[model samples]
Target: MASPLSALLLLALLALPAARDAAQDRVDDGGGYEDEEGEAVEEGEGVLPSPGQRQGSCPSSCTCSPDGAVECAGAGLDSFPASLPADTQLLSLQNNQIEVVPIAALKRVPLLRTLNLQNNLITSAGLPADGFMVLKELQYLYLANNKLTQTPGSLPASLVSADLAANFLTAISPGTFGGKPDLRSVYLHNNRLTNAGIPRDAFLGSDAVETLILSSNSLTRAPLGLPPALQRLHLRNNKLHSLSGGAFDQLRDLRELYLQHNQLNDRSVDAKTFTHSRRLEYLDLSSNNLTLVPRGLPARLVILHLERNAIAALDSQGLGRLRSLEYLLVHSNRVRAHAVGAAAFRNLRRLHTLHLYSNELNRVPRSLPAHIKVLMLLHNTIHEIRAQDFAATPELAELNLSFNRLSTKRLHPRAFTRLSKLASLDLTGNQLTHVPVGLPASLEVLRIQQNHVAVLGNGALSGLPALRELMLSDNALASKTIAPNIWAQLPSLTTLDLSSNALTVVPSSLPASLEYLYLQNNRINSIPEGAFSTTPNIKGIFLRYNRLPPHVKDMFMGLEELQVLDLTGNFDGTPEPGADDGEGGDGEGGDGDEEEGMGNPQKELPQRRRAVERGTSVPRPQKT
Candidate 1:
């Protein structure tokens, strides 16, 4: 592997001079197409034939000049063969192992406009300013991932877009990008810009500069006084602890602002921080220590990212003001109980995505907007979900309630009764003793990994016929979870995640549409006899970290169609009963079926059925 490229092994005829000389000798000996000067005629410049053209004495080197265009990528060459193509407009050296860019080599092609040196080993120490200055026609320069310091050695005046990410440049003076006046986009992220003050000229001279990415730098303040045309700016993962109130005031046309992963406290931001940027739509201030926000933010903000903050809580008053907010991501915050109301989201009519994961709440909030489509509630302290908790969320399509403190006693029968359009449901990482039912009929993805679920009584997901992905790994269930007729119940399930559980057996009749099946880390001496019954469409399977028995036939059976299968962490043999597939049938059946729909509904069934199944199953009181 080369220094800049850990990929793509190919060889190019780097010794173009030798090859060309030898071919010329051969052509001269044959007296091929001799001109009046008695010199053997050879194809020159753009007159060179393709691989299928004139056979004798073809030039080994191909170059593009400032006016001509040349692209020799993926031609099975490891290095840049030589020879200058004059007046080239564009030259691409993509996906090659050319250890060193012939900077002087490019000088021969003075008319070059666009030079793409991406995925190469052109280093900074070898970068000569003279190698780049000759190409006076250069406009776009893509020099990504090539151990370079300051790219291009210099920016040409006509250049428009410059991509220099994933490099090791520690210093960029206003002089570094001095020439480009028509520049529109500049990418300079993932570099060693430590404790450095960005030059005032960092964004100077660019009358058309619109987007700039200076991420992963060491800056304590927002770069103030940006051009008015600046629209998109990315400054994530920087030491921006202080943001001036007018840091972003000059950019009247700014739209998307990404300032995540900074150390800015609440006082660092102000309402007037975005006073004139009325057209702004997306604002990402995630992973910051902002506890207080100034009133009257941009009213028409389409996305607001306040995640991983110390906002403490969100009562009806504070959140009610953002009338036009669409996506509110405040996850990983200290927001706790009594602060969030069901109606708190009712005012945000345009709100569609709400991410409140990792909070300190024991119960679900009420009056959440029914119009919200994506709701993420994972990694919280929620232990109970009342009937009206999610009553108004009718349009919810994706819901993630994983990593909580939920249990069988907390699942309300009508909890999801109103979410008819719900699609993706995540209940992973919790204390659930069973798979609660009456899931939205339109759910497509369900993630319930890492729970205390003990059994799949039956019809656990009968309502979610449209479900495509079901993740239920790391639980107390055993072979009982894997029903051979699993597909018969949920025919639409496409992805199943069942890793880190007490699975001594695998479900044989899983849906054939399953593309991803995760079943790692559990106690199982032998593979289930019904593992993957006719489900050849499975593309991947994870069995790592489990005590899987060495039964070759059962282990790899029906796995030819599987593209991935892991058998990691299988230590012992055990059996648990959480795979309840409503042997009692769909929700139409009274108490027996309710056992799989909602935990409490089963208790409402007549005592006669409980008496009959009491010997076979534990019949808890249903609280319908």
Candidate 2:
């Protein structure tokens, strides 16, 4: 299509009688490319998977290139692979098991473009101060999924696309990408970056960037004064506390924008904050701490993420201005779930995904758009969910209504009667003692964690013909309570979470697709011989935080490929087995079984948590 489009193109087919000549060339050494045993990144694609793909092979730590790039990605490289000769154009080392990338290793390839090392283990690129000078012709560098501590590389003059997501990097040097005038596509999501340390001039001169993603960082201020060519900006999951109205006034041509999961307190985003982004099409501001929505954005805004905030109610006067806005997310805020204004997003005719989970909603409000596909309202104070509430959105596919204050009053028997294409429904975290009847037959994932479900009765899952994941954890379904035919009913069930219940024995009734089973924090004292006799494909199990009797002889059974078993916080005064099971008694007494699974138990976070009801939630539903 165009310059950048040509760079992202992949897979070209050879045609006609020239095929014979191409085959002849393949027979010779100078022949185009040798048929390697494994598949490599198809040339010219925007991204590429690593050797561990279904195609497999190459050393676990090695980076393999198919575009005649031996020096660029060969040998068991634990670091960033060295560069190759000028002939090498595109280089991809994605999904490799690499650990670290030594900065000096990349200087050898001066003409390299499109360097993709995503999903690799390299922590920090550690580029030398002169790295920009050494790889002058390099472009498109992807460094996602690593343990980086800081930005280790600077931008080259010709560099364009860049991705540094999911790293430990804490800051962005201001002058890093100063003068790259034609640079485009910058992705830095899921990092530990901050604003004070960032050079104010980091993006001073790049005038051609179309997309800039800096989500999941620790930024405090909005990086304003961007080039006129900027289009998309992603800054979700940051630590931003406030922003002056003129923060993003420079980007007049901006389109898509994401700013969710940040500390967007009362003073952060004013109505005029995005006044310069008039052409915006997508906007996400969910999971922030905003108390009110100040006015002053474009009427053409689309795709809003305002979930998990402190907004108690909507000031209709403010949200009514956006006539073209679509996909509004106001879930998990201080607003009463039933207090939503009918016209909140009535102008959004193209809305698709709506998230309103973990709020004070007692029931679904009326006047919902009919085109919604994904609706989330789980973990709230909602007392009931009437099927008629969703009649407006007939095209709905998935619905989440887990962890609420609702009691045994079941949802509308025909709750999904109008949802012809409904696929998934979650009704966890409530006072229900059984499965609801309104779930659609086309459902796939049903998460009913942390409820009073003591058994699976008649209408538990009557219409679900294609359910896959069933989360019945934190309930009272002891060994004999879960109907044998309950799990057997869903042929596609794969993940079953029954942890934190009163189950005393594991049931043999399980589906063939079952892969993960979580049975931790329960009264289960032992595993019977045929606990998993039927589920041969099971892979992982969590037996941590339980009381297993000492007299029991065997543990997990029939799980041939079972990868992990969390036995922490469980004890019967067993001796050390010298394994990393983390088992030991609650006290540091000689009992070793209780310590097995607690070795590396993830520490609790300070964020507001959804409190699953005890006998309904795992970990005994400690109050949040």
Candidate 3:
């Protein structure tokens, strides 16, 4: 026998998972916009009903609970239901075809605190004048995803949160939100709001309004005279071109601000624009046209996103005061090696992650932060790695240098010796002919795919006992040049990818703990008996698009845990006269051809195997 207030709280808690799902969909489909309506729904508090509750009458089309909660959602009603519950406190009518809000019907439930009319066809003209002024005890009003051209002229004074997103609103009168002292959150995103449509004092008496979302609008400039108690403001995906000085001087409690995907530049922004927001923590200015980093950022900032800009240089003065910064993303810019000052990042002692990929840098930036952990420099023009390049950052764990011009001759022998804690390294799409020496013994994942690597000499990967994953696809590897027992040194190896190579046969002496082996798109013609004898724990073996002959099922005799054996696109003991050599051209040795033969058997094998019997079936190979 719980109280009616407790039951209403339980119902609100049950709706949170659906709200989170909707929020995630908005974030993914709306181009990285924050979902403020979801937060408003979570923080809404309903009013308590008076004592001596009554079991009110229920409508035939709605489900009524003894706690004064009624649910009539998604009932396909073209008009509002005629409810006669006098003590009802919560009513949900979302996902319906109702076109009007009957003022006479709502006047019956004077104790209503929460009214949800989302996803309806209600228009502005259909709402009667002073429709919501009767429910003086209402606190939460949700009218999102409607056909309203304007907000309701009058609202209750006890309203705590209102959601008007995804509407056709174009203007807001000065008194629309005035005289509401308890109002805190208002959502107006994905609307047609313009700069001139909003008056200067639109939020005049809403002194407690903290979160305001005006993103996805047509505003040319940020709104002036915002509430002083604002904490989070979202203005992304707008047409803003400039910001005047003292624009945000009143919002002293602001913490998170989003201004991405706008038309801002260096000349249009003042240096002291954000100097008043001393407690700001997260700022996103990505996808703009600025050529240099903005100056005069707050000192207590923690995360800054400046990616997808036209920035070309970094000076010590631009980022000298952000000592509390932890994450910095400047990728997809025009930054070069010489343009970066020597002490540009020396002051950021707490920086942990730095992303400089897709730039014009020819070398690593000088004076990197000492405590950095993750560094991404892929898709650059860097050709060499000096010995003392990583001496300043000893705590590095992950480094990605893929899609660069790094060659074996230009890379120093002791280039990565100082990175004792390095665990993951990606050298994909390079020109290295052999494995680099002096790799850290603590490495775990190594990706050298799409390179010109031809040989794996002895002692190349000897000391790496903690290595687990190794990717060598799209290379010039052949069975004769690979050193014997080269993979036995890695005792903890689990996955090995060698697809799209020039190997004529399966490499021997694999690790005993190997679980997944990918050897597709090769020139292998026969499988030697006991080819996988040492690796008894192997679960998946991919030999698709190869010149494998029939009667190779004996290779999987003792593998008790064998789950997947893909042998599609291989010769079925009757070779065609003019058939091309396997998916990756002849096994002689150049960069292998990258054709889409059989389409990544690892991902499609499970479904294809169940549809039709295309490959030979081993004795105990379970279908996965």
Candidate 4:
């Protein structure tokens, strides 16, 4: 039952792995090598000469296709394989014990365009002094997850993308990537690189480099002299404490910048640091030491993640310029209601989701964007909700105010009357003694659990025709206080949870569309036959930990769709006559066969059938 805001954040974090895998797949597959005629040659279609049979044959331990692609990964070789095809265009030697990449072996594949040497034991001293300069046609090189203590100097000028991640590199030499005009991506993350280890002009000549990932390093400040063409930069999980004014002065085309999990503070970032990045669309600065929302954000930003900071206020200077912003996550901060300026979010016309949960606010912030659809303000100290709290946001669909100090008396009578499109409302863990009045008719799910509610007035649920799920568990409701026809107003009601209440017998007149009923942990002793006759489509009934006596099987005789019936922790005594010889009658407390059936009822039916063979009487519902 995760909230929508939490689920969206999880999806964003999981996208990193998918992106990495896609990049690796492009390097591994080589997009199908070309033949001599420049025609596309699909892999596994052309078989080359057998290994160890000729001078230009494939290595004995590798597989070669007619398109000049060789794969020798995980071959357990101590050195580079010999006798590679002279026209090899793609070579994969990853996941091997090869420590040295002899230059002579690469001379055979002078046309190699993609070379993968990742996940090996290759060290700096083991590589050639001039790097892979002999492979003149190389375009993609993957040397990640190796033992290199320094960058491989003088990479081929034709290199387009290089992956050097998860290495022991301590420094990047000046000319490591200087002259490659076609170099577009460079991954140097998960290394021991420091600010001083990189030269000011380390990437001076690589003007085409668009992506630079230097995350998981020991950088205390932004690197200098970044390429002007850089479009995406990932510097997360570093020790960066500040961004000097000129750090991003040259990156005009930057679109996505990730600086999360750093030590950046309000003063550490200059106001003009991002002034030149006008095209920036995605920015993530979460898990930092920021005490205020950074100013001078790009107006074109679509997603901004500033959660898990120490920010205490929101002003027009920090948020007024972002008009295209759609998702704003500022939760887990110290934002207060009074500290928020009146025009803080006045210009964000396209914003749809705003998450300010776990803050210090005592009331909803005024001037919320009108078009926002989801607002999560849970885990706050707000005690009252006024009538105009959400007057401007009529398009809001889901609202969560759980884990607050809100009481029915302090809440205005028409607090939520304006939210005509609100579909789900969660007010759990509150101090309300009764359900809030004037709920919108469009509400489909209402959860007010863990409260002190003891009564449901006659019209408490009158107009909610679209309500599907109502969870009121952990309350003080009693069977006598519940109106018998109260559920008739909700025609679409399917799931109702009334467990952990003070009901003596099952409530009657349940909605006919009810599918699941949870009345466990009550004081009920009898069902009064046909208690569930109206709910013909009910599938699961949980009445455990009650005072029901033995031989209650007759109560569920006509429930054709009943799939699970959990009667555990009840009927605690010796078995009645003609009952099975077991710990309790009707498999009440034995081995939890009935209890475990709550998830998969079909798996527990055989055990019950065996009990019936031992002189026990169990009701078996027939499926149509």
Candidate 5:
């Protein structure tokens, strides 16, 4: 029933008798221990020091905690500190300048469980053959981000994880990790490993290995003899071009396989390469040379990324086995409308995301999964959006059709009527002359920039009660064609872009919730006193490259929340005296005669005033 401290005190008392007996025996031996100076040293004095004087050794900048842990990171140290505490269990020397790990450097710290030497200049030659044999209890070791050309030897058998990534290791020799039965994770990515340099059974000794990361290597063929318990394998950014029979037959527990950015093709992949990877959930085969979807995909796959390939079509058989697939990314391929089968995704009821952007499709793809929530077809040749093109996905939330050949005449009136839950629609860089109508009420963002929409009609965006961002920049919208109450219905609108247009005056009747307003690169000559009076929430306004008028009073009135006001390149006019006093005067006192506009626009105020009074302001005629 004794507490830990009480029992330790009792043991100390018991050891005192034995200590006295040892001292008596030493006295009976005719002489006690002698020092180098022939002085007879008293028994238990400095030789067997008291607990208070038994301090352990540590580097000047390092902290040795009570639990035998030492940390000396970022010290610019060029070598391991001499005389480390023998009981030290954890040592962190990360971010140092130490170039070599000398043999016997850690021989005294036999209890070390974790050793961190990341971000150093360690090389294979710096580590002796049996350099780490002294650390019998080491469980975790990190040598990543070093200059090693080969794996360090003599790793403790108790090691659980070893991180050797970001090094110059060219190959993994046989028995490199031999006898490490408890090894669970190995990170060798970002190295120069090649298939010819690695022995066939390099991983045969690591029977318990679960995660192997070989990404960013030069391996032209898949490594052999993978542990059966492997769950995750990363071979991305490699030269792997093929998979042989039974390549993954033993990896039944594999859940994630990353083969992206390789030279893989149908001819290089075994027809049954993934036959045993039934539990795999994520498969990445993007950026390859495959002309068709590789067959024998697991039915439990949750995500398949095959973008940037030579696959020219969506073959029904290619997707027939992935019934549980939730995401299919095939963008940047050669897929054309005619190459896709009518039932390409017929069995993918759980599919929620599909990416077909940057392809050769000339029409809206059909027969997409019904539960799709995100659809990307941007950078394609699709010239039209006909009715029911996306009718199957009523729950679509994000659709990116930007950078296509879409024109006003090719859009069906009810093209997006079925997508009631749609939240974002991108139509930038298209040929549309006007904003499409019937946008879902739940929409939050609309991008239609770089188009020819000369006019924004009333009710063009009436149904989008939740719209918050509207981008209409780089268009041909003129102030005369934009309705005075164009944004009155967008109560939730927070951002509006009308830059690079033909606007001669700021659009009036902006929404009260407007926050960011971009009107740069336009012909706008004036901002009326009440122009921003109702938009109290306005935060930023861009008015550069415009023909701003002369002296004006209360031009920024009611814009108390505005943070950005861009008036660059505008006509410079003497502030009517008392301009800050909310009154217009015929004064000359000002900050100075600032230069702006194509010429002195102050002389044209009378014309601008008349134009404003008539509820229309045409851009001034340009001189030939």
Candidate 6:
């Protein structure tokens, strides 16, 4: 082997050729870049000339492309530039003070394909009847965030996309998009449109319109005469309280529909509405005042969102018809058990996810489809869970019953025996006295905190072989009530929480796989040596607010891999009654007999034993 200095020099020499080649491959043109028109534009060093860079011989404060594209955005020009390149294909004069668009002045760049005059003071009264018709090649036009009072007309026949959103346009007159065979998308959202303002034939002139966005308007009813090729429609954030039965009968190709944040009520929807939209797949009717699901929805729908509605009932005739539906969300409603009969959802065979949270149901809904994998029932008044509550849904993988009034006695002994595939179960914030048994062996996470569970019986965790996290905090358990081998059967246990209990010492039989142990706010008074010998992999141990013995360092000697050990709030160390007599002791304080036997005649008062306080670092023990 070469010496260290010689090896370092050899590596540097091997990288010299490759580094030089990489540096030589780069070229610099004095920070000048070519534009759309094949002309050079000067920018700063190491910066690419984009739409913000000014070019030579172009208008002041404007960027010109080599292929004849110009951007004069935020230039403060009162009107169109007088000296633009005659062959410019794209012109962006947005964020200016131009009050009018002079087509005669723009006749120079007749080949322009895109024009962006957004965020200007342009008004409809300032333009001629055939204003934009002069640019026959215009394809994409944007006039959003302007002061236009009316929709522009006589647009170029080749136009494909138009955006007039956030304008003052109150109505869409006939022939607004007429004869434009290539116009496929139109945005009229954030306007003052209403039912009477939109003519019946507003979109009759265009047969190729595929996407229409009319949200945040004043419309109270659905728009009519939508093109047959329309696929997506957004009418959210409006006052559409009712929809005519024939409102959507003409849309044969509609697929996605959004009508959320409207004032629609139960009587606002017609019976025959949406019956003709055979290809519809997604529907959102949230934030409405409806009392029930609207009738006549297409059978091919996949996701139905009715969250935040006031619907009170779910009958078989209303939901059973949706054979292909997969997701049904009716949370934040007033639904009751009697309102949803037993067979209300029996026909929804393919349903996989059902959310009925924040409802008025007294118990878990019955007749849930067998394919349900996730069930959410948080924040309800449910007080009990029976063995058959989850018998119908054996494939359940996640069940959330938190924030309820559940009791231990009300929970049947065999309540969770059928959930063989369940992985996560949350019973937090309830009134229980013990860890419910009969849990599946495949459970991985069990949370039962914020309860009155006083003790964990011996067989409470016997069946949970694959358990990894066990949270039993905020209970009234003590070392006497807990079995000595409570944690012995949990071979895969990693995180154990026993804080805020009445423990007197560190429980024994801890598994080797344990990593995090929480025992804070307990009555533990002693930690003997070899207490944690089986748990060498432990990393964090919280013992705050405990009455620990004087020799705390000996208590942590077995924790070789410890990282964070909290021993705060402990004031003094005094042996509990009979603790020093080689007999059972509560370990809370020293007995009077042992302390008096020491007598008060000792010479230096036997140096006071200082406890292991906060921030005391322990050296990691050497591994064997």
> Which candidate has the top score in lDDT?
4
Q: Candidate 2: global Cα-lDDT?
A: 0.61
Q: Once superposed on the true structure, which residue ranges of model 3 sit more than 4 Å away at CA?
A: 1-62, 571-608, 611-624
lDDT of each: 0.63, 0.61, 0.79, 0.80, 0.76, 0.74
TM-scores for the candidates: 0.66, 0.55, 0.85, 0.79, 0.81, 0.69
Candidate 2 to native Cα RMSD, angstroms: 15.8
Q: Report the C-alpha lDDT of model 3 over 139-236, residue by residue, as the tens digit.
A: 88887777777888888889887787777889886655767899998888777899888887888888899888888889988899888889888888
Q: Which ten-residue region of model 5 has the weakest summed lDDT?
A: 37-46
Q: What C-alpha lDDT, on a 0 to 100 scale, does residue 245 get in candidate 6?
A: 59
Model 6 lDDT per residue over 1-624, tens place: 765423433443344324322322221111211111111111112122343333334688787766667778799877667666666667778778767666554565676777877667777865555767767788778776677778876787898878777677798767567678898988777778888878777777688888888877888889887777899888988889888758888888999998988999878876678878999999999999989888877888899999999989988767878999999999999998668878878888888888888988778777778888888888788888988989999988888887788998889989889999998898988898888878888899999988988877788789788999989888889888888787998999999999998899888889999999999899998875677988989988888789875456445644547766666555464432333342333322233222232322111011111112323443333332
Q: What lDDT would candidate 5 get against the real structure?
A: 0.76
Better of 3 and 6 by TM-score: 3
The better-scoring model by lDDT among 1 and 4 is 4
What would the per-residue lDDT of candidate 1 be over residues 36-82, giving only the tens digit for each residue?
11011112122323322222221244432222446565544454555
**Residue pairs in collision within model 3:** none
Model 2 C-alpha lDDT per residue in residues 372-456, reported as the tens digit of each score: 8888877677776676888788888887776677776656667667777888877777788777766667778877787888887
- The Cα error of candidate 4 at residue 477, in Å, is 2.8
Candidate rank order under lDDT = 4, 3, 5, 6, 1, 2
Best by TM-score: 3
Misplaced by over 4 Å in model 2 are 1-206, 209-225, 232-250, 256-276, 282-289, 315-326, 410-412, 457-461, 478-624
Question: Least accurate stretch of 10 residues (summed lDDT) in model 3?
Answer: 35-44
Q: Please give, for residues 147-212, the per-residue lDDT of candidate 4 as tens digits.
A: 787897788889888888777778998778888899999988777899999888899789999999
Q: Considering summed lDDT, which 10 consecutive residues are worst modelled in model 4? A: 33-42
